[model samples]
Target: MSPLNWGVDSAAIADEELLSCVKNNYGMPDFWGRYLSTVPGASEGLTTNEINFLKSNGIKIMPIYNNFRNTVGKQQGIVAARNAIYRAKRLGIKDGTVLFANIERFFEVDANWLIGWVETMFSSTYRPGYYHDPVQGNFNEAYCQAVAQSELVKNQSILWSAEPQTGVSSKTKIPRFRPQKPDCYATVWAWQYGRNSTECPIDTVLADQKLYNLMY
Candidate 1:
């Protein structure tokens, strides 16, 4: 969950009903979208007041991002991404999830950033992995089989909860990838990730969980 990251881009999010639906289904899993101010002149960095508020209210914090400085597929972005992961680790904000915005064709997957992330995040945290669009032939199956390649994207871990594909609604049903029957909302609200028309996933789980486990 977490990372209103991309959700911040959805025009449909402005709808009151849908917004409520999204928040209920996906909010907590979603990281606080635009709350952090990372740069030096910036006015924020987990203030004592906010931390107290969260602690008082029993909220667990997982601040998003390494930095908004670089483009996802560029060398700079890779370094930025690595720095962000390191920052997260240093601040003890590593438990939730991280959207690996990109490792696109332009950027080689084996860059130092990805390698460091695999090493650090695995040793210190339990979070999701978000990656770039896959290339046509990822060095002949090496890319396709992310198991050995990317530690975070390990399928068996089921640690990742992807965004529901742009099309479709819960009314749509997919049989094969029905969340393996876990009742975590972070695991619900389907997304059409594969060619399959339906797959009840983390977002689907969110739909149900937030309906009951709500917060402002």
Candidate 2:
């Protein structure tokens, strides 16, 4: 497993907060997609200074959101995914470094579109195979999970980083989705943090990452 991957998510980072993260040794992934930056500066972008700061801290993997034009469930999000790849290249971020595109909602993805997009994404400088925020009720469509799984493995990828759940609400209600532990999820999470500790703690979420990581 990589020594990096421990991570935390936030909308905008304060200089001090970022500094504190470095001080505490937590990797910084300022949640820059900010739901697609609709407000024109309402959400934060990784500033030049922050980029330098990240470099100083040896934090190289940064997961920013690409605009996923997902509204009516047709999954035009692929367009955003392509654009994000370009941005990642321009910014000198590794391919796998751009971890996710949290869609307007999960499960709204157009399967065919995603399949085609992944085909293209592999050739880029990015490294990870495929990952997305696995928000619950996201996989209710059933086939999406398996299709995604196949794609990730086909790419010989790492983990599929999905959010277990939100709001500290249902830790007890959910059951583990997959039977085995995924190795790349750990690699993915640990890399996101830049460590094991910062990864999303899914009784479900935790195990899923591990299960995926083992793929390659």
The estimated TM-scores of all candidates read: 0.39, 0.55
RMSD of each: 9.9, 8.0
Please tell me which predicted candidate would have the highest lDDT against the true structure. Answer: 2
Query: Candidate 1, which ten residues in sequence have the lowest lDDT sum?
Result: 3-12
In order, the Cα lDDT scores of the candidates are 0.34, 0.39
lDDT of 2 by residue, 1-216 (tens): 322222243445435654464334422332222121333443455455665565565543334454544523224434555666765555555434434444333445554545444444555554433344444434223225435555542443444444444222122332334222232232334222111224232111222334323211
Per-residue CA lDDT of model 1 for 1-216, tens digit only, reads: 431111221211122453345445444222222122344542244444554444354443333342443342335544554565665555444354443332233434433343444444455444333333332313113333444555453431222223333443232332233322122212232222332222212222222222112211
Model 1, position 173, has a per-residue lDDT of 32
